[model samples]
Target: MSIEVGSKVQGKVTGITNFGAFVELPEGSTGLVHISEVADNYVKDINEHLKVGDQVEVKVINVEKDGKIGLSIKKAKETQQPQRPRHNGPRNNRNDQRNQNKTESFEQKMNRFLKDSEDRLSSLKRNTESKRGGRGARRG
Candidate 1:
């Protein structure tokens, strides 16, 4: 099968190494799937996730003129949540907008912040009783 970028295709995992997995596409064509492309998140280890003989759906990322195809497993899965349908009327939710307008005045917020800061300082002072020595006074 001809592989093109963005094409989703099924292939068999032929080999597994520390770095990547070799996938044999239909028609006996093969491509290298880098470790980064193995998952949607950080792929710390590829072998733990895939083994030889496992069939996988992968997206073709690149097809070079020299016939080297780069594949990605992460791109094969669409991560986006399905889009929500828009309401067909004006957004007259005055309650939400009014609540967004700060009910607490700036002065009240500042007072609360300063009081919290004092409590945090006292807590830090009480907890840090390691009794460690400090470096000697430095000279200019």
Candidate 2:
């Protein structure tokens, strides 16, 4: 069958290589299943996942100018759009964890405090030392 982008189709695995697999669809049209499109899980070896003559469902992700289709097995099985898990009832541990994480780490706070204190102390020492008439050169 002619495949279009975003359309899911059934195919038989015709060949497998290090890079991807070739699948022949109903109308004898062939498409490349890139290694990345083989599954939802990582596919380290394509042979382990598919063999010649195996039936598989794949989604057509692209159709090249030459009419060759780029297929994705992972996409064909994707029926539901992922939904953010719902939070029911009142917020609790999450907020507490957020509050705890909101504060600067102890080391950061201490470093900031030490830097400010050093600047203030240095300014104070300079002021006191300047009052001792140390600005200009003394009489030779």
Cα lDDT tens digits, model 2, 11-108, are: 99999999999999878899999999987767899999999999998889999998888999878877645644445534655555456766878887
Relative to the unseen true structure, what is the C-alpha lDDT of residue 22 in candidate 2, on a scale of 0 to 100? 98
Clashes of each: 0, 1
**Model 2, TM vs. native:** 0.57
Query: lDDT of model 2 at residue 105?
Result: 87
lDDT of 1 by residue, 59-119 (tens): 8999988998899887787543443444434453434444575787888768867997999
Task: Supply candidate 2's per-residue lDDT for 23.
Answer: 97
Candidate 1 lDDT for residue 18: 82
Residue-level error in angstroms, candidate 2, position 75: 0.6
Best by lDDT: 2
